[model samples]
Target chain A: MEKIPSSEITPESVYLSRRRFVGSLGALAASALLPSGLRAADRFEELRKELTPLKSITSYNNFYEFSTQKEAVAGLSQGFRTSPWTVKVSGHVRNPATLDIDDLRKKFPQEERIYRLRCVEGWSMVIPWMGFPLASLLKIVEPTEKAKFVRFETLLDTKQMPGQGASWYSWPYVEGLRLDEAMNDLAILATGLYGNPLPPQNGAPIRLVVPWKYGFKSIKSIVKIELVGSMPISLWMRAAPNEYGFYANVNPAVDHPRWSQSSERRIGEFFRRKTLPFNGYSEQVAHLYAGMDLRRNY
Target chain B: MVWLKRAGLPILAHAGALTPLALLIWNFFHDQLTANPIQYITFRTGKTALVLLVLALACTPLNVLFGLKQAVALRKPFGLYAFLYAALHFVTFVGLDYQFDPELLKEAIFKKRYALVGFAAFLALLPLAVTSTRGWMRRLGKNWKRLHRLVYLAALLAVVHFVWLVKSDVREPLAYGAGVIVLLALRLKSVRRASAKLREKLVGKQGECRQVAVHEDLR
Candidate 1:
């Protein structure tokens, strides 16, 4: 109610289908023929990289909020209601408020960015997401000097999400990034992917995308964003601290206690590929962890 | 018709045993093996192996609780299929998942407790699978039965492997563990006698239910 970003129109037209993503490849090629379109196509250099087939991308998801079984999530989440959403930004902010989901895109124009998403389970996917920078949103809320970290929370509606009743995991999934890490340009709060508004299984309406970290770091169906002074204990960290660390940067050298992190199978490929440090975003974000020991932090 | 009755259960067992593998192949071909094919294959094979192992363990209990002495005959085939699936699970991990990279394999076998226990379970089944033939049974005599008891160890290890790998939401694995524990509990002499007493009354005239559990060519 405090930091309202003006009024909102109904959410933009969302083409929530696999065809748009599958068709984008051809569209990119044809658009190259036009001078103006070529610049736009070239802007998304990462798009040319092998996009995980839209079918696999949608069907194979790790939204445990819907189901633990990856394939079942798509089917189980088919009836999830995502419209008429609000995100409350509070804690350690000068102007704490709840903003309409549509106003986010209206305030910060959405951009198309293709990123590689790696899961802690040692599987990977390359996805094209439509969203704006978290830094822009963070600036709007205006964090105070006491704020050292940003904690994100997913919605906790048991009637809507069946997996929420999975008592072993403390519900209302939570994840956090350091103040500096939250401000990084690579972090984006995504609303949609592959020219379509996100399907329920892929976290419809809104989600976070921190490309460098494990997929769990990108909490989905977010309802709350709170800035705090101390490092927040994530669900995984609280569940198995020995395995899942707060700074879960994709470090191949540090193996998960349960499985090998040294290599990962790209979803579509037959063979496993060597995992990159910081998921190949080391060049851009490595300096943030410059002096810290990653192995211990991991 | 008499031959059909004699052969019916074996035929049914064969169909039931091979179906999971066939479905796995069908799914693999149809692009229904989910996003992570290797993982899908791994879980399918591992689950099939564990389930079949439990089924094989169930055969004796079936005979013990009922007068169907023929149930003991299924123990061998079910166990052999369990071994087959366990081997496939191992190959999927070592070959497809890791591409037989020795360094990674070494690291995993040492670092991951689940891998180590799973490998031990496979090793436990190896001797039972090998000595399953009549030739080896004739060769070892009483020793053969002693060696074959390692299957109980294999079943226990496989369940532990499952429990460890699944970090949380352990209801599935724990259920399997409880099953193995109950089956193993059925092996106790006192429990077996009590069950046999109950079975004798239930089975009435078919009093061939004397021996609660006997290793009949159990490989």
Candidate 2:
């Protein structure tokens, strides 16, 4: 049970508040002034007193488009081109225009939201993501009456991302959210993390951040947003339909074949913590599935 | 050359098996084990155990298919190394990862099918590991060979455990499964006889090896 030093524990918030809190206060003063993120209702305050280091958050990743190996992703995705990127908002939308990455940033105000990302592989991380709500972005591109689902596609450059063309999964990784789920406040299109514009590994320019679902639903380096009439099958669903479903919402009771969702190992924590339903965002997002059966959905 | 075959080969085998473990320890001390160190260690050890198990299983097949008698000499050491790593894998799971929590351990063993099969594989290997010594081999006599047949079941279970573990992309595990299958297939009496006959008809026909490798009595 080796402990990370207390000094390194509260290191990210100051350096992370890059754009908004620029030169406002000293690092020490800012840490004191800054609100310790959404841990008020968190019962394990004593257990997880500090945030996961920005180094760990950046280094340990599940960017399969870069590599299957988690640690190798950061290094492999080094040369991935992000700038001059255009995210095409197409499919069943009123204003189906391909917006430039920079102009899109200007259009939407980015705010930092610290969310606990529970991976389907039983590992979890608390990431301070800088982005605007997906609802905000969705409002700009008004969905037509036929738009029942929102499908996202990651960048498909095999040249930039070495693992893109891998046969293990279909190319240009696709994830879908119901129209209501897409409009959820908790769901955001993340552009940056740890007070910095995303490095190539962490989805670079823009990626989805659906906090309540398994991390895979948060597709990275999104190149296309298709508002579809039918429920779009995600890449995981195509790969293993039985194991991975369309709605990959984090549920403790739903026991996966490989790893149990009942408990998860928070990256920094040594002991396994009991996983929460909807990843503890039940109050925020649970009402979306009021009458539906979660087990079948899972 | 005989001395090299007798001593040097065993030493090389021992070194080859132990080096990854040494490197893992070195990485742990150097802070190079990435973010989730426990997971890194678990993956490394489990992979090593699987590889060593595959290598151990391949030894007899190598002898049967090609009459490489020296492969037999390496089997016990490789099997023992695989057992050591399997034990370490379990210890890491129960102790470091789960923190010896009884409830968590029970749930992991019972609820997770992969864990159950992997644990069963470990249990199968335990008796073989305990009776691996010459004294125990002498005491067990003919039953030693019969008891050690559990290695095949252990290997199969390990493959099943691996196959079930992945969410998608059965490619990597399937590659390992193919390797295990080939090695296991080579062990079959009919497959061995056919392969030996094929080799004899090709290259071994001209040589002094007319007796088509009935060498591995365990086969």
Candidate 3:
């Protein structure tokens, strides 16, 4: 496993203290100190992208579990319960167990990773996600050699997620990645955002964050993680096979049948910027698809 | 009641037609249009175009099925409104969204299938809009009706463009598709003939009234 740089890891106490200091400064003073566009954390300066405002990140989302309308999801997700959540890790594993959210948090040390989220819908956002690498959790479960793919499932409570009642998509949205991709150092099971618990609309409790793939592959509000021999079918692929494929890597060369993928609009910006292949994580993730044709897979 | 029918109804229709654009402008000023204001504006304008197009198509059928002669007068205004919204939708995409980048716009029109369909629909509406005036109607004479029939094709293409553009949850587009189909079905020759026959049977000796109604509407 690749080691995270010690300089990048801010102690939890320091993080809390900084938040208090920033909050005490209030909105007007903070705006005076930092320019509007330079809102991202100092640690993420290496990425050269601004963090999408927390308002935009929480408000404008594609969690179809709440509603198809991007603006409606945040409001509709207000009733959802994240605490007392338990995640079931099973299938093709030596030690399959149902772990409580608290247990999962205590067992692994969390790290804040700033990653660019490129949506399949031609929009992008940089998010400061706080979570541990998914590999640590998979190690605890002890996946057997037969585990070729890792499948994820979201919560299915229709009362909480009203869009599940509609036939737009099948219930309990499912997503999957190859076992190797799941085990990658960049892959994270995010628990929080902006140093706070994950917002309900942004997939509260826990969510997957595979930065290289389009945002949908990072399925939200996860309840199940399973390892299987054969490739697992995902919801988007089942809904529209031609438009959304299994790999769903952010590729500028390959366009979605309906829209262009060559460029994407950053959330707060008026103009679009050229999209990056594998969402600019090409060095880390491009090797995974070597020898295979991405266009065919897409 | 007579004044209301003669003048008030058309005024109401015009106001109704402009409400979406007005509401969008209001939302823009208030900062209530969501995170991506451009997307909100584009979608609202596109939806307004489709809705007005459907309403314009419905005008002829309103007179055919019912004896609403005043509804035929609404066709021109609604058709023009539809064209205005479609033009706005196109301008927003090419100007605001693409920022007049010819290469990007060209790629969108040529390479993207949905864009091609949507642009085709807009192009089909253009000439009809230009010739909508009374002078052009008089100059074209018999050819005017033939030219106006192109609205049906434009409506079909517009609905298909919407259906193709959506990622999933196509219920909204499907409903619009159903509306277009229903309007087209109502205008079919066989359906018109059956309706005429039914009108003739109902009015027996006063059948000239039905012919006059058909001439004014089906034209």
TM-score for each predicted model, relative to the true structure: 0.89, 0.87, 0.89
Best prediction by DockQ: 1
Docking class of 2: medium
TM-score of chain B of each: 0.92, 0.91, 0.94
**DockQ score for model 3, please?**
0.70
Ten contiguous residues minimizing lDDT sum, candidate 3 chain A: A35-44
Cα RMSD (Å) per model? Answer: 9.4, 8.0, 8.2
Model 3 clash pairs? none
Q: Write one digit per residue (lDDT tens) for candidate 3, span A8-94.
A: 999999998996676556433764686432433332454545888889899998999988899999998997999889999999999
Name the lDDT value of residue B88 in candidate 1: 97
TM-score of 2: 0.87
| Tens-digit lDDT string for candidate 1 (A1-298) | 5665545432344333344563565455544455532443343464547788889989999888889999999999998888789999999999898998888768888888788899999999989999988999999889999999999999999999999988889888999999999998789899988988988888888999998999999999899999999999999998888889999999999988777899888988988889999998785589999999999999
* lDDT per model vs. reference: 0.87, 0.84, 0.88
lDDT of 3 by residue, B1-219 (tens): 889869786898899999998998899899888888888788999999999999999999888877677888999999999999999999998888889888778788888888999999999999999999999999999999999999999999999999988888788899999999999998888887787778788876566577565766586
Model 1 regions lying over 4 Å from their true place: A1-44, B199-209, B212-219
Stretches of model 2 off by over 4 angstroms after superposition? A1-49, B1-5, B195-216
Assign candidate 3 its CAPRI class: medium
User: List-wise, what DockQ does each model earn?
Assistant: 0.71, 0.60, 0.70
